[model samples]
Target chain A: MTQQDRAHATREAILHAAAQEFDRLGYERTSLTAVLARAGLTKGAFYFHFPSKEAVADALVERQTELWAQVRESWRLRGVDPLSALHGMFAESADRMAADVVLRAGVRLNADREVGYPGVPSTHLMWEKLVATYVIEAAERGDLRPGVDPEAVARTLCSAALGSRLISSATTECADFPSRIREVLGHVLPCITAPAWELSGSQSASEPA
Target chain B: MTQQDRAHATREAILHAAAQEFDRLGYERTSLTAVLARAGLTKGAFYFHFPSKEAVADALVERQTELWAQVRESWRLRGVDPLSALHGMFAESADRMAADVVLRAGVRLNADREVGYPGVPSTHLMWEKLVATYVIEAAERGDLRPGVDPEAVARTLCSAALGSRLISSATTECADFPSRIREVLGHVLPCITAPAWELSGSQSASEPA
Candidate 1:
């Protein structure tokens, strides 16, 4: 293998190990030594890849943001309108959150302001802004009810989504995350759907599209 | 003063001081020494009032539970219907959360499961159950939209409320918590309120009744 290829592999190993530790112990409690031990790498090799644990956490948050962006683009590329894209985007998100260690670690780290990791922007804010853009687009397409403010609808949706994750995680080890989010959409979507769109709707947004 | 009164005052002082420390430092980072210092009490006095920090957290959670019960009873005594009682209960809750340090500390501690304070039940579950009961009552009174599940609306509302608090605190020091929750109710309430009640509704549930 090329030297560059080996370096990339080493870096990926360190990141994966660190994410596991963070996912298990949370940001403040996770230690650098434990990460190095998990990665089976020397201290020097670990330092060569990243400056500090906080930097590793920041990278994880960035990667999670990228995951959301990818989901958003994939749905948009399918030629679905903004309202329909939301169902696709969040379904992809719930699937990733349930299985990806990095995504879980990043979410847990970002939620913890106590860790003082200000190197990266708030992922929740980014997620909310993305949802807001969709809401605005849906409004322009006359999918939203008249007199509904796009920003308000977006904020409410984002809040409810996060709340669902918290409640589901607490109650059922997050086994019901998808259904919880679906229920949120089911109740809120009916209130916001335009009269024309409501009449045209064949199924609820919470259901498979 | 009687010995009983003096002992009660001492316990209250210790609890108040511990809450401030938890609010500032969170569950994992807060040290018992700091709480003692903040309360300006000797080690003997601290031990006399509480056995450990975990016990203190348990007490705080119990106290927060009591606060919710107070709000629920106040609304029930007013003879308001189930749907209307929710508005009053949540408004009072928001006011208490905004002004009470103990309530803030309790919420923070309860959210952190890492502390292992299983001595008390999950407060979120209790709150959700209370909401579910109200929703069921509303359904029985023909206040809810037909075919809507009372438990589902209750779950969504509770989740949205927590999400609003998380977002508001992260962005605006929680100054807009009331309005954020109001927006959630505004969007979701219309969907759940029966069409018959919809016509009778003069003002939005998001607004003061």
Candidate 2:
């Protein structure tokens, strides 16, 4: 392999080891020596890649941000429609939550002031804009109901996806996660779409109100 | 006050002191000496009430769980319909996210298996059951749509609420939190009711499936 490729692989390996260690041992108890020992790398190698624990953490956050960016980009390539893209995003989050609860927890913990990755303003604005753009496009294509607010729909969908990912971290069973995503999408998508009118009031008065 | 009431008050004072210490210094950094000092109680008195740090944590969890139970009882007394009562619960959680972020964080962190709280299962299961009962009641009351599974709806709703509380802990701002809870609830609540429907659709073209 090329020297650059080898270096990239080594860096990724270090990060993977670090994530596992941090998730298992937590931030305070874990040490660089332990990380190096687990990674099977020399102290010099560890230092060369990450100057400190915080630096490694910053790198982890950066990596996650990049990964999410790619996921968003894929949605853009697949379809310019908002509702479908939003559902796809929620589905993707559910799959990730099922596979790696640690990753979900890591994301929640790292986003705080303690980890200190403020992220870009553009990135901060991305979810809303992406959803809003798709919603606007869908409206133009006559897919949405008359007078539905794209911004509100986008915000609601984004919040539900994020909230679900956060919740899945605490749950022991991942069996129903995808179905939960579908359930949220099913309720939320109809509210924002033209087809909502087709649903008759077939539900009974169940909850005490 | 009666002797029993005085004793109960002192025990609560100690528990409150312990919660604050754990929240401020975290689990590892906190010490029994510091907790006793903060509570203005002697070591003997502290030991009389609790044997160890874990005991204190258990007490706190029990206290919070009781608070939740009281909230449930209060909701029932209000005589609202099931769906409205469910909304009231979400709204209370939102308010508490602002009112008691620290307690919420402690509960969320304690729930983490990595963090450890042996007592969480019984307490958490009780809370979940209570939520499920309310959801089922809502479904039966015609507040939720037909064909939506109450158990699934309850589980997802509880998860989302837990997620929202965790997210709230990471920030000082509540400006967006209330709306965020509402947004998620708006989507999920319909699935538990009859003839499920979401609120609105995006204005963009439908993306490729």
Candidate 3:
């Protein structure tokens, strides 16, 4: 590998190891030594990519945010309706949360306050904004019921989504996270959707992206 | 104070201090020494009431459960309808979360998995059952729309409530918790409740109980 490519590979490896540790041990208990051990990298290489454990965590949060943005952009490019796109986005994210250790760790780190991570609140606000933007589009496209406030609906759904994930993590290790989110959307969509518009299928979002 | 009354007060004091410390510092970081210092009791008095930090957390969880039960009973006694009673119960709990440090600490401790608290899962299950019971009663009384699954609806609402509280705690230290939960119910109730039974007022639940 070229020097640049090798450096890139090492950085990705460190991130992967950090995410796994955070997901498994949580942010407070996870140590740089443990992450180094998991990555099988020496201290010199580890410090070359990241300055501290918090820096690794911040990078993970940034990466998670980028992943979410990509999901939204992909759905938009596919000409999916705003409402369906929102559903699909959460479904896709939940899939990642279940299968991808880095994404799962990012989520856990964002939710944990004791870590003193600064990006957690902004991450939540970003999701809220993204959901609200879609809600507005859906409202304009005649997808939402009359008199539904896009911002309020967005906040409610955002809160519900947050709650479902936390509950799943606490109760079941999120084995059924996809279905749990589907259940939340099922209850919520009927209230927000225009009576005339039928949901193509409630299970569509849970399908692998 | 009599010996028994004085002992009871001391135990309560210790739990209160522990809750505050847990709420402020989270479960992993909160030290027993901090709790004792905050309670103004010596190590001897603290040990007299509790064996260890884990024991204090367990007692807090138990106390939180009792507080929830008390809210439900108070609403039931007042002849509130099941749907309204559920709203009132959550509202009252949120109020306590904002004003009562012990309850807030209990909630944070329960949510923190790194603490390795055993009662956490049971606490969530207990809430699910309580919500389901009320949802079943509401359905039986024709308050909820037909074909609503009590268990499913209960789970959804329970998850939503959990999410709202967590969000509020994280963002605003729960200053807006009452309104945040009210918003959750406002969106959810329309889906679950029969159209005939209007919520007396969305903000009514926020009123002092």
Candidate 4:
């Protein structure tokens, strides 16, 4: 393999290993040595990729942001309308968080008080901006109801999503998370969308949670 | 004052002093000695009320819950409809958290991982259950849209309320929290309520966020 490709592979291995450790043991308890062992890499190789466990956790957060950006791009490529793109994005994003260990670990670390770095823009705000971008696009497309404010809609949606996940983690079983998301979307959709607007394909945002 | 009245006053002073410290210095930085001084009470009196800083913080949480219950009871006495009571409860709760030092401290302490007691029920669940109770009342009053699930609406509202407050704290100015809450209520209201439903005299839920 090329030297550059080998370096990239090493970084990915460290991040994956770190994510698993962070998810299972939390940021406080996960150690560099355990991560290196999990990755089956030498200490030198691990050091070349990440300086510390904090750096490894930081990379996971950055990776989640990148994953979301890619999701937006894919929706654009699929020729979906802006409103439809949003419904699709929420569904896909929820599925990814549930199924992808690295992304889930990033989410957990984002909430970890010890691991959080103040002055950095919140990952929650980044997601809000992304959703706001789509809400603005939907407005430009004349898909929103009259007098609807895109920024307000975006803020509410972002908050609702976070609250749903937090509440679910606290009380409801994990399997019910998607249902909670659906309930939120179903109620919220009718408020902002023009009556004529519809979610793309067979999907319905108005479905009961 | 009666002996019971004097004892209750002492408890209130200790709680108030602890709330201000917890609000300003956070749960970790606040000290029992400081709280005693602020309350103008002896260690003996303080010990009669709370055993430790953790107990003081827990009392703050319990007080917030009690305050919300009183709000609900007040609404019932005013003969407000269930859905309208829900909106008023949100507005008043938001206002109280902003204006009342004790309530604000309770909120911050709830989010503090170092202070969290794992086995205790999340205060968020208590609010969710309270919201759900109103939703059921709304449905029985023939106020809900056909086929709308009261539980779903309740869950969405609770999550939305939480998400709005969290996001506002993370980025938006604190003053904007009410607007964020309004945006959420406006959107979610349309999906669950019968089209003829209204939010009581002079207060409209459909205001553009």
Name the regions of candidate 3 deviating beyond 4 angstroms: A1-14, A32-51, A113-122, A140-143, A197-206, B1-18, B32-55, B79-81, B113-122, B140-143, B196-203, B206-208
Note the DockQ of each predicted structure: 0.42, 0.16, 0.40, 0.44
Candidate 1 deviation (Cα RMSD) = 4.6
Write one digit per residue (lDDT tens) for candidate 3, span A1-209.
Answer: 99999999999999999987787677778999999999999999988989889999999988887887787677778776788878877777777787787887788787664222323555566667878998999999999989888987887788887777766666666656777787777778888899876644233634655
TM-score, second chain, candidate 1: 0.81
RMSD list, candidates in order: 4.6, 9.4, 3.9, 5.4
Tell me the interface RMSD of every candidate, in Å: 3.8, 5.3, 3.4, 4.0
In angstroms, give how far residue A194 of model 4 lies from its true place.
0.9
Residue pairs with clashing backbones, model 4: A159-B163
By TM-score, how accurate is candidate 2?
A: 0.68
Write candidate 2's Cα lDDT for A120-194 as tens digits: 232323555677887788788777778767766666665555445434433443434566666666666666677
**CAPRI class of candidate 4:** acceptable
> What are the lDDT figures for the candidates, one per model?
0.75, 0.60, 0.77, 0.75
Q: Quote the lDDT for A3 in model 1.
A: 100
* DockQ of candidate 4 compared with the true complex: 0.44
Over the stretch B76-189, how does candidate 3's per-residue lDDT look in tens digits?
Answer: 787867888788777778877888878888777776652223235455667778799988998999998888788777777877877777666666677777777777777778
Off by over 4 Å in 4: A1-49, A111-123, A172-174, A201-209, B1-50, B111-122, B201-209
Give the TM-score (vs. native) of candidate 1.
0.80
